[model samples]
Target: MTLFSPLHLREVTLPNRIGISPMCMYASQDGQVSDFHVAHLGRFALGGAGLVIAEATAVHPHGRISPFDTGLWSDEQVPGWRRVTALVAASGSVPGVQLGHAGRRAAVREPWRAGAPLDETDAAAGFAPWPLVAPSALPAGPGHAMPAELTARQIAHSVQDWHDAAVRAVSAGFRFIELHGAHGYLLHSFLSPVSNRRTDRYGGSAENRLRYPLEVVAAVRDAIGDGIPLSFRVSAVDGAEGGSGIEETVHIARRLAAAGVDLIDTSSGGITTDRSTDTRIRRGFAFHADFSRRIRDEAGVPTATVGLVVDAEQAERLLDHGDADMVLLGRQVLDDPNWPHHARIALGDDSHDSWDVRYGSALGPRARTLARLTASGETPLTRFSP
Candidate 1:
């Protein structure tokens, strides 16, 4: 299939193979999406992305990566997300969201603020840090505080929280729901041997480590029903010493597929806070393609690959070569919201037929005029050139 092909997952059919990868904007207030979200996300839909997955939204307040991250923990957050989904749907794109819990990575400042853990000086300035939780009481890195180990009751409560958030996501008009099981978050913390040293069922063995995440997945699937597409984002490799490798991740993907997950959004690393200490795979173009291809082939699951997927031909090649079923773009789409439509033209559909009527009606004529100028051996910047 080509990059412009449709992807059918459960009852939803994405208009094209290009998807907008979830990237936290960190622009919310009290976990509510602001005008920035509507404008920012709506533009991607309007720009013609087949699937538009919003940022990593927390399932609970304490799970937020930063205080400003959006959340779906309460009924009050539903309507705000519904606005996003409605606009995206109206633009002919499927609206989706990634549900996440930052775990020990929570209660931190935004990436621009150094992404460090908050301390007393920050609390005095009104951004107080909350108590972090994980499978074991461990700090994410050197300067981060050691999080409290989650008790059995708390783990059960967290599962219910994920279910409740999934219910809210359905109410918010999302057709697809993705669980953020990567990036050294609560789920990843439990999965990685480097981070999880617990003696409980939620740790120790690989099967035991998969326990909590699978329970949450099953619960979320039941909450959202069978009609919605469920995706799980996994760090294909933990990129650190004693972390889960590709083989371990394949087993995890198989379990996730069995638990009713429709797609595996393959990503890697982020299990360690110290970049220097990370033994991550090389950061080449389409870096996660090999991992995604393996998971899709061996585990028998559809997979999405992201990382340096910056162009139309490159995205097409990923799908064309069977490396992934879908190609997800992060910064590339941010650089050009209309990358999908532009890609359509670059891939030989130059009629601009895929663009929205409002923009195409004007741009269609502009494109012709430029082509005519070039044919006449005339250049718009020729007068200015030395």
Candidate 2:
């Protein structure tokens, strides 16, 4: 099946379409990786994800959405990331990193905490939330501080940060890199009119709104050369009134595809305060399935459909039906990192012998039982035993 086929881009080859969605561990200290990151990511690779994307990594100190967010802004962070890439690659999964800048969403409290906007007191205590920068001075929430409007010079610098981060990602042994243009982050903020109300060249028209992000993608392509694949994760809509629509996203995706982006990781919403609509389609649901297909058909760029995509049949049918080229599992992968291994069995590949020898002895019987149960429409491996 196309879903299980190898995805070849440049010199980078994903062994399978299964990708570990970049999930923030929030376990870093001063933007440095700890043992938690190593173990957390390493296990997913071992569990058989073809592509393991490290969590959203901030390109600058203040660009972090929270104090615990990982960073690739400094040279010191590369060594910590190297440990992760090495392990993932050793497990045969191509390791990648998602480089991002949180923009107006930056410097907030960690999710486990209240996630309330951070204040000067927090910044002074070393968890300080600095004034976030965005295309407009929009605050992400009521209590969130209104961000300072980024000047052209600062915008240029921000683009440079993305370029630099791409270089650092390669140095850290990542074979693939994706720009975090999704989920109301920096690039998404610029794309959505609700968040970017600037009259400058970086805003106003759709072309203007896409200028900054396109420049960033171009810069990253220049830095990383043509050997590795670069992807862009985009929030296909703002979900607020007058927010960007799929027609606009298709235009952006077309340009990005021309500018050397390999795949478009399609996700949606997060520009405005409208979480109601966002919640309705939270699971592996692409808001504009037809639109995504149009992008792949017309623009000819491979797409990765994410958000609430659960189960092998749904993922396989997505590719089988021509909706997207790949399926990215986020929370589902978290729920079971070995989902791919199980999926391969369900699809009748007969490669059950490919399970890692370390775990193969036990997995053989377990895979048989799971596949048999799954055929009967029951899953007994919901909770794995250590």
lDDT of 1 by residue, 63-94 (tens): 99999999999999999999999999999999
Alpha-carbon lDDT, every model: 0.93, 0.84
Candidate 2: regions farther than 4 A off:
120-125, 274-291, 365-386
Model 1 CA deviation exceeding 4 Å by range? 383-386
Clashing pairs in 1: none
Reference-based lDDT, residue 234, model 2: 80
* Cα lDDT over the full model 2: 0.84
Per-model TM-score, in order, reads 0.98, 0.91
Candidate 1 C-alpha error for residue 74, in Å: 1.0
TM-score of 1: 0.98
